[model samples]
Target: MSAYVVVELTVKNAVAKDLYSAAAGPIIREFGGEFIAGGAWSALAGVQGHPQGAIIRFPNRDSALGWYNSAAYQATLANRDARMTCSFRLIGN
Candidate 1:
C-alpha cells in the first residue's frame, strides 16, 4: 500500500526551515518519497490546527517510516525542531 506523511506546522525560523527543507528533500527522494502538497492552508470547517501543512507520498509505509527514522534524516532533527513546531503522522493508503 502507498503511504503518506502528513505534517502540520508553524515555522519560527524561515532560514532554518529552508535549510532543513533543502537537506531533507534529497533524503526523502532517496527513500522513495515525494512531497505531494504543501504550503499555507485554509480552514473550511471547524478550527484549523495549523497555518501550514505538507503531505509526502511514499511507495509504502515502510519507506515512509524508514525515511523518517533513517540516520540521515534524523540528523536534521535538531535544526527542524529549533525552527518549527510541527506534528507528523503516517497514513496508509
Candidate 2:
C-alpha cells in the first residue's frame, strides 16, 4: 500500500519556510516521496486550514516514516521550528 504524508503549517517567517523546503525536499525525494501538492488552497469545507498544506506520497508507511525521521528532515524541522508550527499526518492509500 502507498502512504501519504499530509502536513499543515502556519508560517511565521517566509524566509525560514523556504529554507525548510530547501533542506527537506531532497531528503523526501531520497526516500522516494513525490510531491503531490504544496501550497495554499481554497477552503470549501467546514474546517479551515493553516496558510500552507502539503501532500507527499511515499512508496509505503516505512518509507514515509523513514523520511520523516531522517537526519535531513530533522534538521529542517529544527530550523523551521523557530519560525513555524507544523503538524503531519500519515494516511494509507
Candidate 3:
C-alpha cells in the first residue's frame, strides 16, 4: 500500500516556518517522499481549516513513519516552537 502524510497548519512566524520547511524538505525527500501540495488558496467550501496545508506521498506505511521518526527531521523540529500549530494524518491506499 502507498502512504501519504497530510499536514494542516497555521503559521505564527514566517521566519520559523521558512526555516522549518527549508530544513525539513530534504529529509522528506531523503525518505523517497514527494510533496503533493504545499500552498495556500481559498477553501471555496466547508470549514476553511488552516491557512497552510501539505501532502507527501511515500512508498508505504513504513516509509511514512520512518520519515516522521528520522533523526534529521527531529533536529529540524527546533524551528517550530510556537511558529505554527499542526495536525497530521497518515493515510494508506
- Among these predictions, the greatest lDDT belongs to 1
Local accuracy of candidate 2 as per-residue lDDT tens digits, 1-93: 999998898989999778878878889999999999988857787786677889999999999999989877886776878878878999995
- Give candidate 2 regions above 4 Å deviation: none
TM-score of each: 0.95, 0.89, 0.85
Root-mean-square deviation of every model: 0.9, 1.4, 1.7
Question: Whose TM-score is greatest here?
Answer: 1
Per-model C-alpha lDDT, please? 0.95, 0.87, 0.86
TM-score order, best first, reads: 1, 2, 3
Instruction: For model 2, give the 10-residue run with minimal summed lDDT.
Output: 41-50
Q: Provide the clashing-pair count of each candidate structure.
A: 0, 0, 0
Residue ranges of candidate 3 with Cα displaced over 4 Å? 41-45
Q: Provide the lDDT at 58 for model 3.
A: 94
Off by over 4 Å in 1: none
Q: Write the per-residue lDDT of candidate 1 for residues 1-93, one digit (tens) a residue.
A: 899999999999889899999999999999999999999988899988879999999999999999999999999999999999999999995
